[model samples]
Target: MTFTPTLSLYVARGFLLTTLLMLCALTGLVALFDFIELLRRAASRPSVGFDIPATIAALRLPFVAMQILPFAILLGGITAFWRLTRSSELIVARAAGVSAWGFLTGPGLVALLLGAIAVTGVSPLSSAMLARAERMDQSFLRTGGGMSSLAGGRLWLRQADRELDENGVAIVAGRPTAARPADPRDGFARFELKDVTVWRLSAGDSPLARIEAPRAQLTPGTWVLEEAVSFGADRMPTRPQRIELPTELTPGRIEDSFASPETLGFWSLPGFIEVLEQAGFSAVRHRIQFHSLLATPILALAMALLAAGFSMRHNRRGGVAQMIAGGVAAGFALFVVDRISAEFGEAGSLPVILAAWVPTVAGLLLALSLLLHLEDG
Candidate 1:
């Protein structure tokens, strides 16, 4: 018998509601743990109140929900299918000539819709909230205030000069790259900045001097500027072939100052990645995030299929609990594979596309194979 529109709607509604309910339950549980951790950290800071941790937890919930959505979809689909099978609704349809795939179509479409909404709508809002959360974290929780700023496709870094007893700022035209000869001074020339401009400020907050260089390298406790020109308040502009300025900044500190990939929205990532790469920074993490977002919908659909494959068996053939457990295990296995592939992708050992899409595609194929065996064997 053909699966009517009414039946499809029934299945779709069941899938949607169950998925939403599961998502809420999982997100709430995760948020509670996160809030507790934040609260614990806040306790050490006399200036922080309960409201600050609570606010941060609230802001982070949406991003956490998105991460948990796939498992919710899997469990929701399993519950939906298990219910239909136990009620003999699906079994009756099957006995009357309807195929498992017929009923699966509705849930699959709903899963796709959910995934699309998450990627195009929810991600942007969550990313914005996450960015705000990071700002609050840095301002209130971290020892240092903001140390870096990105504008007009340039990177700016703030540093304290202990040796000179002054504060300085630098603008970098491109990303920092590995410096040659590795700075024998301390092996600190791990990275070098390009098209650099440094500004030193006096104790009174006035500009003490301005230095510009085509290339600059970090060595132990100072910045070595090559072919630099210096402008000072009391002297005519002087051109120096090499100049060394005392600094407390290191390569690791500068890298840590950059914004994380998660703070940028999906729609904004492409442009941001372009600007980062143009400025000579590594965009690998951003590229992985973009590809992963693009693959979310397909992964959702695959999760639905896997759920159905595991839970749509006849009631007479028991082991329902075992089957459901298997589905959950499979979901976790997919998650582990995704993380491993992502690590490889970040390390440049795997292509970004394969790292992002391989697990989703493999899950879909495996689900199809299982369903085929059950339907025709």
Candidate 2:
């Protein structure tokens, strides 16, 4: 059967319109809930006024949009195909020797293109906004104001160096302030942490040496402290011009401590991963994130095809509810498997590439098999 370009464009136009409307509706609902949550958090902090929640919600909207894009595509595809089926337009085309696969090609490609645009274009803006929102939230509405210096962040990692002292405690504070750094450039994130405190403990975790430094930076395998003051158990407190402390923690690990992979844009992830692995930290999570983003376009296309397969049946042979339900169930199943695989990847039980790509491949194959039965059989 010859598939006409006119038909393809017509189908693509309808699908794109529906997808965009669905995106707007879903994005608005998400923003409303996020605003409420931010408002609740801002209640106790005087620095955050009523307007802060709105600002935070706006900043977070793109990330939320990215999260729900697949579902939006699914629903949009279903809506578009079902509308055509109900109006008998698709039936007419089918009667004229048009195949479901041919008719679906346009919408499938459109979905894939949208997915790519989301990952490449929208993601960088979303990442930047998300990072800003997180920082703003921490600054204004964070609980435990002064001692928050001691509180853990989302990227917190604890490394024990037995060689330094069995009972020694190191307190690292501050985030990396660097921006758009290349992988080989002093591992920019390592220089971002400031205000370091080290405590030397005796047999029972009693303090033996208390070192306070205004600025501390993590290097390859050591912490360089500037203008440090040391207070010993028996000796008088002494001022040191520079104190270099041996550390098992690497720059990669320190970089991982400040920001999550999602908070970094797609363009920065590869360089950041290199920096992470070079400094002796695990890059599994970053690699997983990168591969997952790389798979988004194909995943979106699969979702579109699956949605059409589920909802394109003739109304004369009803069961729309069941078909749509099955599609949603399949989507949720894919999500669960992806989460499980990611956990395994992060735990180093599974290879990063396998963990990231397995769910995507499985989803696509499953959708393709189901569509073959529905479309060809």
Q: Which numbered prediction scores highest in lDDT against the true structure?
A: 1
C-alpha RMSD in Å of predicted model 1 compared with the true structure: 11.9
- Local accuracy by lDDT, each model: 0.81, 0.77
| Model 1 lDDT tens row, 42-136 | 88999999889899999999899889999999998999889988999988888877787877889999999999999999999998898888878
Clash numbers, per candidate: 1, 0
Please give the range of 10 consecutive residues that has the lowest summed lDDT in model 1.
163-172
Give the per-residue lDDT digits (tens) of candidate 2, residues 164-271. 577454444444334344448654445434466666554456656777777676666677878888877776879677887766665544534456778888898898
TM-score computed on alpha carbons, candidate 1:
0.75
Instruction: Record all residue pairs in model 1 with backbone atoms less than 3 Å apart, i.e. clashing.
Output: 175-279
